[model samples]
Structure formats: C-alpha cells, structure tokens
Target: MIGDTPPEASPSPDASVSTGEKTGADVASAHKPSQPQSTESHAKHAGFWALALGSIGVVFGDIGTSPLYAFKEALHAAAGDGVTRPEILGVVSLALWAMILVVTVKYVGFIMRADNKGEGGVLSLMALAQQAIGKRTAVVFTLGIIGAALFYGDAVITPAMSVLSAVEGLRTIPALENSISNELVLMIAGVMLIGLFAFQSHGTAKVGLLFGPICAVWFASMAALGIGQFIANPQILASINPYYAVKFLSEHGMAGFIVLGAVFLTVTGAEALTADMGHFGRWPIQAAWLFFVLPCLTLNYLGQGALALTVLDASQAAGRPFEEMNWFFEMAPLALRLPLVLLAGMATVVASQAVITGAFSLTQQAIQLGLLPRLNVKRTSETQEGQIFVPQLNTMLLVGVLVVMVTFQTSSALAHAYGLAVTGTMVVTTMMAAIVMRQMWKWGWPRVLAFIVPFMILDLSFLSANMLRFFSGGWLPVLIGACLFTIMATWVRGSGILFEKSRRDSVLLTDLIDMLKARPPHRVPGTAIFLTSDSEVAPVALMHNLKHNKILHEKNIILTVDTRNIPRVHESERITIEKLDEDFKRVTVHYGFMESPNLPKAMGICRKQGLKFDIMATSFFLGRRSVVASATSGMPLWQDRLFIFLMRNATNPTEFFHIPPGRVVELGTQVSV
Candidate 1:
C-alpha cells in the first residue's frame, strides 16, 4: 500500500526521471516550464455551448438519470407492496428537498468556496487542510486519498446504473418492448459503456463540444414537461416550499432517514461541478448550473410529482411511470421520442467522460505527491495541456464499468451500490473542510462548528443510508478505495523518512570546496550541476566530487527540482536562485502538479537567465543511491520496500530531467534506509 498505483500498474509520465541537486542563490536554473503553453494562460473564449454541454455531460450523469429508479426503490423500502400514494409523494418530496439543500445550497453555493487554486477535488481540499493544520497533515492526506479512491467506485457504478435505467425505459412501449429483451438491454448497455471508455483514448475535445447543447435540450425538455404538469396541478408547487421538506422531516423521522438514502441520488454528481473547476473555470460552471440546469431540474422534479397526484393508481404501475401515465407520452409526439432517447444516451456518455477525466486528474496529482506510481501520460491536444489521455486508466475503468453492468443487469440493483461512494467522498470532504477552517483559515471554534455542523449532518445522513447498502454491495468500492489510501499513506511516510536521513548525512558545498582546495585539480570540468532532494541542502555528491578530483569546477550549481501541490504557479515564482558566493549557486525550481519538468527546456530557461555555462563545459552530477533499510533505519520495512520499488520503477532522470545523455554522470551511494 505504498503509492496509489503499484509500479506494475502503469508507466510513469514525463517527469519520472528528475534526479539532480540544486544549491546556491541561482537555483532558478532547475525550474522546468509547464507546457502546451495555452493552459498557462486564462481561458478567454466564452464557450457557453461547451460550458453548458460539458457541465451537463460531466455534472448530470449520476443525478440526471436518478429519476429512472430512485422513487421506485424508496417507495418499496417505505411501504413495500402496500405502498400508499401519500408515501410515494412524501419520498419524492424528500428527494427534491435533498437536492435543493445538498446539491444546490451546500455544494454549488458553499463547498465551492473551498477551492485550492483552480483545483477542487478532495485532495485539493486536503492541501487546504495542510495549510490549516501543518503538523497534522497526515490526517488530511489520509482523508483525501480515501475520498479519491471512493470516487473510483462511483466512477464504476454511475455508468452501469445510468445506462440501464434509460434502456429500462424501453419496457414502457409494449410493441417496442417485445423486440428488446432485458438481457438484450443489459448487453447493449455493457457495449455502450465499453465504447464510451474506448473513445477516451482519443481526447474529448470534440465530444465535449457536443455535450452542452444536447444536455441543454434534455434539461429544457424536462422543464417543459414539468411546466405542463404544473399547469394541470398547481398544488404540486408546495414541494418547492422549504416548509414541505421540513414537514416531511418532522412528521416522519425514522422513515425520513431511509427516504434520504434514495434522496441522495438526486445530488450524486454534485462533486463533479467543483472537481472539474480547473478544466472549465469556476464562473462558467456556476453560470450553467444556476441559469440553465438547476431551474430545469427543479421544474422537472415538480412536474413528476404533479403528474403523480393526477394518477389514479400509483402502485399498479409501480416505478414505470411511462407505462402508467399515458398523458406524458401524449404530451410528446412519437418523432420526439427517438431523439429524446438519443439525447439521453449521449448525456450518459458525457457523464462517463467527466468521471474519466476526474480519475485522470486525481491520478496525476497522486503521482506528483509521490502517493501514486508514475504512469505514462500523453498530452492529447496541442492546445490543451489539461486534456490528457492515460491508456491504462481508460482500459481499467472501462472494464470495471462493463463488469458492473453485466453483474447488476438492472439499474435498480446497481443503485444499491451507487450512493455509498459519493457519500463517502462527501464525508471526507467535510472532515477535510473542518481541518481547513481550524488550521488554515484560523477560524474560531464557534465559527468552525457553525460551518461544519450542517455539513456533518448532511454527510452523516447520506453515509448512514449508504451503510444500509453494505450487504447490497457497498463494501467492494470502500475496500478498493481503502487499499489505495493505504498505499498513498505508506509512500508518504516512507518518503519523509528517506528525505530526513538523506539530509542528515548531506555535506555542505562550502565545507567540501575548502577541503578540495587543500589538494589539486584532476579533471577538466568548468561547471558541474548536482541535483538534491530537499531544496534547502547541498547534495552529498558534491563532497565526493571534490574529494576525488581535488579541485572545484569554475562554476558549481546545486539544482533542486521542487514539485509543488498547486497545479500552476507564476513564472516569476518559478526560479528562486540563491547565490552562495565562491563560484557556487543554489537553484530551486517550482513546478505545478499538472506540468512535466522537461530539463532541457529548463536548461534553456537557465541560459536565458545569463548563467555562464557551456553545454560541453558542464557535467550533470546525480546521486544514484541503492536504498536499503533495516529495523534500525527509522522506517518500517513495508515503507522501505515501497520506496525502493518506487525508485527502481521510476523513470531515469536522464530521460525525464532532459540532461544531455553523454554529459550526465551518476555516482552511486549505498544508504541504509
């Protein structure tokens, strides 16, 4: 359980090979510039259609498709075979309230406030937590990795359930239904799921363009349906009143809890809106949801309730409203039905794409933080650095989703496993948020409690409901996420211990140079660049270099390549060089998680800084250590093994750090871990 992906899982992306020490005031030479350059600039094009579709494609997948079966299952849970009309409306009303409170008020309105830079996932929040509770960073990192893993679970289940529910709608038309068996429906869904992931190998730039307009149409159609239903029965408007939600809660306490489990389905994908903030920017997503998506969704849910009241027999039709309610079909002509089906299918595919993108982003951050093994990631678009494609992740996710579609067969059965992962993510978010408020913001206890209490209540309600799904298949995802979390924590601890020991034995550059002056020159080297791990220290290789040669290079630069938590930083912020006089320089390079450290490009930038260096005159020195650890080495055996594996499997810095292959020299130092 060290690193999110095992070394065997995938190959490292571009930066996996960085190994050089930075020292002196000129450490700026070590910094690598982030690329596909445009991503560095703010997105200026007001792509309303892309924003609309992308938000819909990404945001609505889990919740948009919930209406297909949420009420049916909740009604069954509440009253079983003898369910009453009032009970159905009550649960439906609860579902509406949960969406308004959790998705609309909490996530869209509030939790979005806690974004870390442009990043908005649980890990980003954990970074905020680190700023808040410095010494207690471990706790926050643990929560983040767990929350991240659970999202993978959600990723697996959301597609299976969404597609199944839509295909299940085919059962409504008796003539059309006879041509499509349920098994056929499941198989078709499985194939579509596979195809959706397969298409991911090709970036979603074009597909993402199609997402907004289709989702806009889908939402508008749903709203139109709701308005029509409202025109028939205005009393259904009461559900929109917060009073009705409070009434449902006060009147039915224990029953309300079970209702909430189903109700959570309405807000399952709420996290996506914030998690994908980096790709779309905060404003576009906010504008799309508030101005377009939310109102339409509210109208549609209201219309469903209004339509329910007009029905004379609710239980006889059970969950299949299309079959029981003829007026709804009459409201839409036959020509529109096929287009609606196509739109729905496309919307689900977009939803899948969003989650897939989220998984990639999460994995990227994990690698940068040393929690995950490096993976071979390729930039899919020249214009968009953020748009990346990871083949291994795409394949694994596709297989997992299709397997669930095959296993569950029906969306309803899959629903039992859906909400738990989302709720778990929400729970961890709240925990990380509390830590952020207390530690980073320096908020008083009362203010922290005031902010966190409501979140805790909401998260606990959903998590408790999801707990009911444990025997129903909730445990599988939690187990997967737990395994991932364990690996991340293990690597973090291991890396910390190794960093500490490396620093302990490190020799100061000044001290080593003084000793070399006692002797004489042995080799021809004008400038030597050595890489160090901890940005503050000089690498031990400097001591050995001078001790063996009995001479100092005319110019010495200690370069430390630092990977920061944020996805991006200003260029002015990139190179912080400290000149340690006596012909020595220390350079610290700042890189965002989203960027790759192309060393040759960094060297070009270094040349631009007026640093005197000859490509032929310089020698790149790297401390290549074969790390070995025993019980006495201060790190646990598991962690030691984990770090060694991480080092062995990591890409060689000669390739990753962009050093001239022939000029680069590595000196081996055997160390007890």
Candidate 2:
C-alpha cells in the first residue's frame, strides 16, 4: 500500500521475477497444514502490574523527563518582570491543571475509549470516524494527516530539546562549569543521539528489558527529591487550587498569557500515551499514569515550585539576580548533583527512544493507509512485530535533530520551538476526538458538546498561547509540518487519480476470460497467477502475455490483496477463494493495516480450500506500469511529476509481498497520468 500501485494492482516492471522450480512434494511440504497459531497470546499472560510497569517505560518516558526543563523555562519566562510569589503559584497551578485536564481527563478518560479495534492514535481515530460516517470525508482525512505531520515535527524537536536540557544539568556543577562549554555539551548530546539511532536496527528486545526498571528508578528519584523540597515548604501545595492560575492570568495580562506557552511543556508528551495505547492496553497506561507517573510529576513540579519560591525570596532579599539559577538541577543535593545529571541524561535518552520508535510506527501506519511513499521497513524483532526500523526515516530524523541542536544551541532557545508542535497536535487531537464523540459514540448533541466544548477551549487556549512564539523558533515545526502535509496530500491525491486511470484502461475480467476461451491459445502445462488491483478487471500482464507469448496456462488465478483498516485480520478470514470457471479462480486475501503481506504463506492457506499449488509448474504474471506525467491528468503538473517520481522509487512488489523472484514474470507498459 505504501507503493504507488494499489493493493490489487500488478507489481511494477522493476519488480524482480523468480524462475526457480519446486516439485509437487516440495510445494506440498512447504505448505503442509499445521496446528492453528494464535496471535493473541502475547498480551494474554501480561497481568495488570506487568503491563503498567511496561507502560511506565514506553508511554511515560517523554512526559516523565519534562521535569528537566518545564519549570525552569516557565520561571525564566516570568523572571523578566522580577519573579513574584503570585506568579510562581499561578504558573505551577496552571501546569498542574493542564496535566489534569488535558491528559487525565481528555485523553485517558475519553479519547482512549475511542480506539479502533484496540488501536489508538490520530489515524486510528480517523479510521473509526470514517467507518462510522460510512465514508472518508475530506475534513477527517486532512485532520489525520495534519496531526501525523505535527507529530513528526514534535518527534524531531523532542530528542534535541530533552537531551540538551538534561545534559545542561552539568552546567550547574561548579567543578564542571569552567570546563564544560555549550559546544562540548552539544557534541556529547549528538553522540548519544547517533548511538541511539544506530542501535534501532538491532531492535529494542534486549535493552527494552531495562527501560521499565530504569524509569521506575527515575520516577522514584523524582518523587524523593520533590518530596524533600515539598516538606521543607509545605505551603507550596496550595498552588493546586485553580484560583492561583486564574488570578495570575487575570493580573499579569499578556506576560501571563505568553508564559502559558512555556507552561505547556509540562504536558508535552501526553500524546505519546494515546499513540502507544495499542502497545500497552488502556488500563495499563491509565494505571501507570494515575499511580506512578502522575504522582511523581506532580510532586516534582510542586517541589520545583517550592524550591523556586525559596530561591526567589533569597535572591530578592540579597538583591541578586535569579535569572542565572537552574532550579531543576539545584533541587538536588550538591553532593548528588553530578549523579543526578547522569540520571536525567539517561532518562532523556529513554524519552528520545520512545519518540523515535513512535515516529517509525506512525510512518508505517501512514504508509499502509496510502498517505506516504514507500520506504524500506525492516522488522527488527521477530517476536515483536511492532518493533521496526525505517532507514530513511532514521537518517532524516538524525539530520533534523542535529540541525535543531546546532541552530538553537541551548535548551532555552530550543524550548521556544518545541511547544508549537505539541500544542498543534493537541488541538488537532481534541478536534478529531470531538468528531468521534458526536458521530461514532452517537452521543446526544448536548452530551457531546458538554464533554468536548471545555476541552476544545482548553486546547485552543494552549495553541493560541503557543502562537505567541511562532516567530521565536516556533516556525520550525510549522514549516516541517507544512512540508510533510503537502507531500502526503499530493501522494493521496495522485494515487487516487492514477487508480481511476488504471481502472479506465483495464479490460473486464469476464471479457478477458471469454476471449481466451474463444481464441483457445496454445495451452501451457503450468498454472499462471496474475496479480491485480481490481478484481473486476483482467490484469494488464495477462493480456500482454497472451499478445506476446501467444499462450495461456492450463490453470489461471487472479489474486487481489486488501488492506483493511483494522489492526489485523483473523486467520480464519484471511483468504477468500471463488472458482470463476473450470480453468480460472479469483482469490482475495485480506490483511490488517498493521500487517505485511506474504503471497506464499497466503497461498498455503488456500491449499486447504481445494486450491493446489506446485511452485515449479506455476508462473506469476505481474504488470509493471511506467508512469508518465501528462498535462491532461486530473492533478496539477507538479503533483503529477511528484507522483511519477514516487512511483519510480516505490518498493517493487516482488520484495514487498515476499514473492519468489525466480517464479515471477513481469510485463511492462507505459501509462500517462
């Protein structure tokens, strides 16, 4: 589906063909019926606590590391007017409520319930909405693409900002301050990022074992440090009241509004929780968030607030500047500062890992949905199908991250670029979730509005605040997101036009069969399988073969593969076979968007349904279209050119479907779109 060709279309001419032969016994042995294999066993044995622990590592990594800079940046944003007690309390209260409202209530309480066949994310939600509406509306599709694009924008900024912020902790150490420069920190962070991406190809199966316990330790340390500070100044707990946030925003005017942009950093990674719902079930993520992540983050932020108040009072009394202080690192005991820095660094790396892998997963989904060009996706873990590596994506992310680090140079500067992407994504998520509530849940208008109106206001408010930063490095994500949106839109539009053109050019399957019967071509001994996109039409390869080779096989099969919107197709419903005539069969195979198609294995399943296959005697016929852009095509000239370029580079069907090269025979033809 990632390729330009439709799922039922023949392979491109560039696809490799196999001429290898397998005897009847070999084919029979290769496809022998065995005990039914169940794909649902992976999560069956995982208890609530086990899954919760796993969720802590993967789902909470990004949000958990926010304590590294969220408070610091928010305070810095307010420091220009000389930090006030009301401002500190108000900012902390705003952050606390943002987390409570945006994440706990909106996503955990509502949106997560809208999973598409146990899958959750923008695309999954889009699919659910489309299914409920009985058709794909342009609005829903565009929202999904925009959300996905913004996620990539967020993905690039996350590693650079998180890692830079964590490593910046070293600047707090007096012993290292003189020796560690910003360049050295950037170099170190760059190396860690390089190493992190380089290891993606190896799969996370081995190291993933340590993510849970390590994050557990990280969270425990956060709570301990925060609790130490909170106990020292118990009054800081009063900031939990919404009144402070209201009073601060009311009194400070534009400055307070602008500070909300920085305050948004507290919940930057909330989307990751929903994005990863399919990996760990909803309850596990919810339990982890409510029990461990939420409390730790709350305590840490409160502790940071308490520490900031003390630092502010002391600085005011001493007539010194509070601008130079890095309260996140300063909250730790002086003796443990270096170790804390190392811990924070490791946690940020874990956060980076989560975001990086999330980008990979999202890209795959987009490809399956026909929203992007094909890239070589390598399954890194044999047991963990979700663990995949996209080499092109990795290189692109690495380059983007490095550029961000080099250009921004510091976490404070990069933070200005970070919130826009997250806020934009949050806004889109709220919008899509609203549609789901109204249309899919079939909720009454009053109930839907009651639930979504408040969340929309909250998300839009955050988005508006983030817009204050558009010129201050926020444009970076917007630029990246816009470009990605264009590419996806162009591909989807072009693919649709091309599909229509192919349909118009194709001959009807019945007519082709009838013509073959009337002509009575030189009968060949082998079985011939023609891959096609439309079952209603005969494949171009079949017609081309008859015209050139002047022969027809003893038996013929037309195969079409359908990628469903669901996460996975059940084995029982995978293959559908119909005997069109004594010499011909129409076989359709259904796969989930989350799955990769395998022709041989699918054919093996058909063996039980009276379909016989002898690899040595069977020949595969594939149509490879050499697409050319034409002025009369429905799409604009630029889009037509882009489509042609994408088609030229698409992964050949031979490799994509895992078809045997030696048994493949490709027929080439040129088509103008």
Candidate 3:
C-alpha cells in the first residue's frame, strides 16, 4: 500500500487574486502590515461540496489514475519483453515502496506541513521563502514557477493517457472487439475533454457531488478486486516484504533507473493534497488516504501481480503483463468489467480537472505578481468560493490537449511524454520544501537534511529516467513550459524596470503641494482622486492639472488599493486615511484578494468612516504600463515581444476595476523591462 500521507501545513493565498504592492516617489509610503493570525481561522466556510468535490475531484486525479500504468511499466523495465512471476511480484513491490516513500511519506506526511496561511501551492511556498530567506527567495521562486509551468504539461498528458488507457479496456471486452479502434477511442477521449471544458463555465458544483462517492467506490472496487485475487493466490502476498523491494533494486542495478518514471506516477498527486489543503483541512485528506486509499492501492497492485503470475509465467510476461494475464479480467464477471473501465475513465477526468484548476490558480498568482498579463476571470460557483474558470486559458488548454491526444493517439505513446513534467515539478517542490522546513518551520539542520536527502535522491532519479524520453517526445512539454516561464519572468522584470525608471522623473506629493502654493491656485470645481500603479511615481495627471489649469482641486485624494490573499479583512484593517492638511488625504484601502474592490462600495465604506469623497469628484491617475513591452533589458527578445502580444490582448483594467469610464482619465507611460 502507499504509505501514510505526509502531514501537511495550511496556508491561504490563492495566486488568482491580484494584490500588487508598490514603492516609489509620488506614491504614498507605508502599508498596513499583514497581521499574523491562527492559521486555522481560514478554514473552508459553508461550501463543503467545493472543498469535498474539489479536493477529491480536482486534487486526486493524477495520483488516482496512476495505477493504470505504474505497475505495468515498472515490470516492463525490469524483465524486458517477458516477466517471470517473481519479477512481476518484485516490480509491484518496488512500485508500492515508491508510492509509500515518495507520495505518502514525503508529500502527505512532510511537505504538507509547509502551507502558507492555509493556502498551499508553489507560489505560497515561494512567498514563505521570500519572508524567510530574502534574496535567495528568487531562486526557489523560479524553481517553483518552473514546476508550476511543467504542471501545465502534465495536465496536457494526464487526460490523454488516462482516458486512452481506460478506453483500451475495450480491447479486453469481447463485445466491443470489432467496434473499437484506436482512432475511435482517441476521438472519444478528445470529445470528453472538450465537453469537460465546455461545462467548466457552468461550474462543477453539480457533478462534483458525485466525484467523491464515485472515486471512493472506484478505489474500494480496486481493493476488492485485488483482495479477491490475493485470496486465490495468497503466495503473492510475500511481495510486500521489504526484502523483495530491496532485492529487486540491488539485483536490477542500472535497469532500476528507467522504472523511476513509472514509480513517479504513483505519487503524482502528492502536491495536490497540499494544494487542496485549504479546502479539506489536514486531517480529512490524511484520514482518507491512510485508512481508505493506501490499503486499496496496495491490495490492487498486489492483485495485478497475482493475476499476472497465473497465465504469463512471469519471465515471458514483463513487456506487456496485461496482454499475458487471463486472471485480471477472467476472474471478474463480464458485467463488472465495463463498470471498472467506466470508473477508471471517471477517475482520469477528475485528475484532469485538478490540474486545470491548479493552472487557473497559478495564472491568477502570475497576474497579481506582475509576471503575467491580466485576463478575464469568472467565479464559477456561488457556493464554491474557490471555483473559478478562465475562458481564454480554457480554450488554449483544450486545444493543446486535443492536439497532443491526436498526435500521440495511444497511452503507450503518450507515456513517452508524461514523466518529465511531473518529475521536474517534484524536484522543484522538494527544493522549496527544504526552504520551508529550515526557515518557516525552524526545523534543526539534522531534520531538514534528513527530509531532503532521501527526497532528492528519489526526485533526481525520476528526472534522469524521464530524460531518456526527451528526444522520443518528452521534450515537448518541458520546452513548452520553459518558454511559458520565460514569458512570465520577462513581463514581470520588464514592468519592474519601467516602474523604477519612471520614479526618477516623478515629483513627491508634499513637494508638489509646495510647488502649487508658489503658483496661483485656480481650483477645479470638484475633488479629484488619482489612481496609481506604483507607490513611488507621482500621478502625471496631477502635474497636468498644475501646468495646464494652474490649480489644484478643492479636495485631492491620493488613492492606492492593494489586494491581498486573505478571504476577509477586519474593520480596523479596511481604510487607512491620513490627513495631509488643506483638504488633501492619502487613502489606502486593504482588500482581501478574494474580494473584489467596488469603487462605489469602497466609497460608501469611506463615507461611513467619515472620509468625505465629494460625489462630483472625478478620479485622475496615470495608468502606467497598460501594455507590457519586451525591452531587451528585462526579458529576452522573444519574451518581450510575447509580453507585448499578451498585453495588447488583455482586458482593460478600466472595466475590471469598476471605475466610471468617462469620469476617469487615463495617462499612459511606456515601460520596457
């Protein structure tokens, strides 16, 4: 059985919310510091379905469907074209150990303990590294981002392989022998993938309800299947001995490395457990895994081996055990075989959903961090607070997945492309976990080294194993992910450089006010509030107001709104208004990243708090870098161009921020990073 799930930490910071912090000359200095609270306070609200279904539905996908091929491939690597009973048993034993050590022990038991504020994901970990390690944060941050990008590649492959393998069961079913073809099976998977995305806008609240029970039963059935087989061939139970696993490894020698790819699949969803920690809490997932999942997985893996021994005479069955095995299907009633296939297919769909959701969350964080251009984001379910759908991303992923499915066509072919992306992600997670253990958890050196050493050996083994497939097709996803990562890094760096360069020419508010006093004060009729991108740059519109109109408004408000990841803010944390004398106020609004900033709502909030915003006041601000460009300095040539391309297509913030279109004036500044 997969070992006990590792203990995990809970932190609540979804990357989807844009909460940029700014620094500079014209911008007001100082921000309300994020206060530390009991991490437990950020638990899931009323939408248990979102948590339950999403956690089970989205998070369990990759790992859940892993059993389809993990053992099969492992055996093939060990015994070549044919496997003996002993070899099959040994391979299953090795696979069980890999799952236990990598998934259950490393991730569920240990890595989960590193959540940031109840939100657990790569970026949240990166944020922790920033607070604890300072400049070194970027290194880990980059690695984590690369991991996240690689996840996108995994997402592309999971659905392709899982669905195909499940449909391949058609080859096993006697009735569909003539009707099913590889093209037909692939087309079915492609249609299912498309339909899956099409339904995303409607949200998963409805189908999600079925996911847990369905998957629970699916795991139970696999365990049942394995247990029944084991009862018949009890001798195979000896494979669970650690001696079998160690013996297989030492005896196999160099050949063992290739098995790492297959082994990696067993632990694919480890990160998801941590990523979904905010939804289900630490205990439920752990409980579900330890008591329910582990036993079932172990039982099923053993059963597969037990069944393999009956027909294939272990030595000749290594390359394709299922093709040689009669017991796996023959032992089951015909009526139940199709059900198992359906269950496997559904499990694969769930796995794909989890990766898709992760992608959405990651994209949101990239935008907020200025690493990515803004996109139109919609919350899919009212009840499921974290349920979100991105239309553009949805279409893009759908197309990418379809192209891959069509091109690869078979699960075995797609397998060549699978492990590299997930392995890279695993490596990145370990590196970040090491940072968290040392810095945030304040673990001693011995404890930190103990955790990372074994994990690194395992992770690198998979990475190296996957490298064998790079030229064969594995390079596709890595290349795609790396290119995508470069685009994000470039845009972020470019924007930062532009923001910095603008500060030199900007005037300070206090100094600007002094300059206004020396000139004749001709007043505009009403108050004017200027929106700014940076805390350091002065609003160019304010300067425009001075030079052209020769006057400042009767009341001027310098407003900076910061969106943070916490769900809700305390009343004391809402609006901080500092008087600057002569009807001028510097207003800073702190919004939970999950909450949208409504100008009208916020204006009313200010009204209730005694900060007067004259109804007639029109906001004037310089909106800098409305478009991102690839200046050679910040990002590479292609990335700068790509950033510009994405920026040009991005939705204008004017509509997104809920500002009055006509009343708000936009002053654009060109920026190249």
* Top model number, lDDT: 2
TM-score order of candidates, best first? Answer: 2, 3, 1
RMSD of each: 8.1, 7.5, 8.5
Give lDDT tens digits, candidate 1, residues 1-673.
1122211111113212111212221243235355443532223233444555577756665566565566556654565334454554676677777877787787777677676666678766765566445433456667877888888888777777777776666655545758878788987787788788778778878877776676677778878877887788777776665665666567667776666677777788888877887666666677777787778777877777676666635435575432333232333446565555666677677666777888887777667666665565666788976687777678877888877777777777787788888999998887886776676566799998987898899789789977877888777677767766666666666666666677677756667555556664664558898877654556756666756655567888888776665666567567767787767788767676667666666766777887768878888888777778677766778777866786677667675566689988787777776
**Candidate 2 local lDDT, 72-123, one digit each (tens):** 8888887776888888898899889889998899888887887766677777
TM-score of 2: 0.93
What are the lDDT scores of the predictions, listed in order?
0.68, 0.83, 0.68
Candidate 3, residues 511-621: lDDT per residue as tens digits?
A: 776666777477766778876554334576666666665677878877776644443455666787777777578887765434444565676678788876667565655
lDDT for model 2, please. 0.83
Q: Give the clash total for candidate 1.
A: 39
Write down the worst ten-residue block by lDDT for model 1.
Answer: 1-10
> At residue 327, what lDDT does model 2 achieve?
76
Which portions of model 1 show Cα errors greater than 4 Å? 1-54, 59-62, 79-81, 133-136, 229-235, 242-255, 310-336, 435-444, 536-554, 581-583, 616-621, 624-673
Which ranges of candidate 2 are over 4 A from the true structure? 1-46
What is residue 217's positional error in candidate 1, in angstroms?
1.7
Q: Compare candidates 1 and 2 on TM-score and give the better one.
A: 2
